[model samples]
Target: MNFPSFGFGSPWVLLLLLALPLWWVARRRRPPSAIVFSRAGTLAESPRRGQWVPRLLFLVRNLAIAGLVIALARPRSGGRTEESLSDGIDIVIAFDLSSSMLAEDFQPENRLEVARAKIKQFITMRKNDRIGVVAFSGEALTQVPLTTDYPVVLAAVDNLQPGQLEDGTAIGTAIATAANRLRSAPGRSRVIVLLTDGVNNRGAIDPRTAAQAAGQFRIKVYTIGVGSRGLAPVPVGRGLFGLRYENRPVEIDDSLLTDVARMTGGRYFRATNAQALDEITREIDRLERTPARTHTYTRYTELFRWPLGAAVLALFMELGLLAWRAPLL
Candidate 1:
């Protein structure tokens, strides 16, 4: 179980605890004298109470003193408040839903599936940041608005598939759409992560022009070109034989992606496999982080009453025992 902070308010008073052992030694050295009788054997045969009663009374006196000393030290336990100073970055992830993302060169799954998994992992890591999602093919569509609700963003990314929109890469529209979403975000740092497997070939707006617009709006763009450089297997159709795979040349505009990154003062990465894509996302996550500042204050509640009560109870018991054992004066 977790406990609250506890300490003494007047710690110097606790030094009095050192006197406990000395007091015990003093009591031992000056032992009480007993009367001696000629017929001591006969006295032993007589009914007598246990010798431990007197020793218990002595122990109680010492315990009373210890409790009083601890009470004087003013032990306390209590309240703390913490405040964070750093703000979270606003991010929009633009995914290319073009048919090119269907390439199975990434691994056991296609490029889009791997991208979705990695994107979800990235979302999990960024707990404090608000994230949005944009899906693009021939045109761009904002699947999720900028929000701190990560589950919604993850759901949006998971639902993305090839051919959801027209069948052409729209890099420029995707970047422009992402930038527009972040334009009104309150965070000082706004970022867009654009992942594509094909070159821009269908959008009315040029990719460079959109990148310039993102730069003008002070939005950083991290571009990732997904797919192998050479030939990759793509699924053709399901015919008489089970699934059919055909080797197709991988086409990705690295120079254009790099220019987009440069224009927005960000970095471009080429991911040939799932591991490489994960690494790239991790690197981007590292670069975009801003340290959070925190301030903590504590309040204390004094706990002297409990020990004080114990001391009084012990002292009263000792006095009562002494009075009961005393003879009439």
Candidate 2:
């Protein structure tokens, strides 16, 4: 086991310990006898064996004095503790699960798979932040609520699929839903990360109106449009064994995305491939960082009682021994 740090509150009191040795030396010097003997060996028959008794008493007295000196120094034991001084940012990630997200322009995997991996990596880079997840296609759905549990958010991101909702993109609805989740967060900084690959084709709300509302609520929205320019292989339907793909034009509403981000005091990013997507996440991470502070303190417990008690006990033992030897003396 580990021992707590030890210290003295009044260290100057320890100077008293230096006097003990001088006192011992003075005690050891034999004083002149009150009655003189005719010769030096006249009382040789008397027992000299008990001469150590007085020395034993002196030793106990010195121990008692030493204990008292230590107690006066105010010994104590201390332990350190730390606490976070700020409530970090709160964020909600809005993911697009439209059928178009299955486009294979990102290589090795589709756009949605690459997005999930990057979102998980972003979550891992954060500390002291509460994060939530929102998945949208034809409409928006809250996959996870605002929380500090990163694992839950990661799991929700991993479980997101294109067919969960309908087959269209609702960028406006996704932003509105994510903004609502962050409006009530207690953090000073609240954010919405909207990652979509298509324009807003289905939703009751307008994208610009949602962005204005988010700005009013002091929530910033960082928009990321994911896709390669020109033609890409997009999955249309399932065949006899696997998915069928066709080359289609990649369409991303870049102008509208930029407008939405600007209205909400955020920036817009375009991810053409997996590497760009990773860099976008990193950029957002840098932009949304909240400078958090921590406070450290050390608590001390008084330990003077033990030494004071030892001092009293030693004095009592010396007194008892002296009383027991009184009759013989």
Candidate 3:
């Protein structure tokens, strides 16, 4: 829950509090008696009933004075509000799920697993942007359309597996599918982030042709090559106990990826490990930010009425007590 900000409009009025002590001392002093009593010691010898009545009246009167002083300060509560006055960017993520992505180059987790984790983090970092998801192997499939709903995008990324589609890297197809999704998106700028771990060999469209098509629509495409250098452990077949692993040479077409990025006025990134992948995503986030202007406003509500009422009520109570117990006081 958000709390309102509290403050006084006329804070200088609080200096009146300094005079309270002087008033108290003056009230405590007794004036000289007009007539002297010779047997006054006899009255002093007996205990006085309701001796605390005067003290109680003084306390009530002091409370009333304090409340009135605070009311004069013009206390109020305020709340601040902000509004954004710009459109957000539209982005589509093209994820590769080919067999090569299963390579355990990032240790403990496969390349695809680490990529999924990083992509999920990337999705959460974006604000007010509509994001879409495209899953591709031998062919491309749109897992989600452009939307501001992030949970649905994260769920689609988590559910992607190595064998969900045909067992080949369709880099060109993935780019084409992502560009199609962003062709008429609701934003001034449209973007595609395609992460692949292998060379293109299955798609009907050529990688360069797809990049040109994206360029025609003025959509920026950021390509990412994911994997470590040299060999990486991969699952080949299932054994009696569990899945079996075999080291395989890492393969990623850097030139084609770079060309695709350049043709669409974007940049190509190489992620050798998990840390590098994380850094690449952060860099992309910094590059394609939506410009926005924010306007802030503050609303204040007067709270002096409450303190004023309290002061009035305390004065009434003090007057009633003085009338009922005048002799005791």
Model 2: ten consecutive residues of lowest lDDT: 34-43
After superposition, candidate 2 runs with Cα above 4 Å error: 1-81, 85-87, 292-329
Candidate 3's residue-wise lDDT over 156-216, tens digit each? 9999998889889888899999999999875778999999998999989999999999999
Q: For candidate 2, what is the lDDT?
A: 0.87
Clash pairs, candidate 3, are none
TM-score, cand. 2: 0.66
Per-residue lDDT for 296 in model 2? 65
Clashing pairs in 2: none
lDDT of 2 by residue, 198-293 (tens): 999999999999999999999999999999999999988999989999999999999999999999899999999999999999998888867556
Residue pair clashes in candidate 1: none
Q: lDDT-based ranking, best first?
A: 2, 3, 1
TM-scores, each model vs. reference: 0.63, 0.66, 0.63
lDDT of each: 0.86, 0.87, 0.87
- Any runs in candidate 3 off by more than 4 Å, and if so which? 1-83, 292-329
Instruction: Arrange candidates, best TM-score first.
Output: 2, 3, 1
Residue-pair clash count for candidate 1: 0
lDDT of 3 at 27: 69
Give the winner by lDDT: 1 or 3.
3
Q: What are the C-alpha RMSDs, in order, of all predicted structures?
A: 9.5, 7.4, 9.5
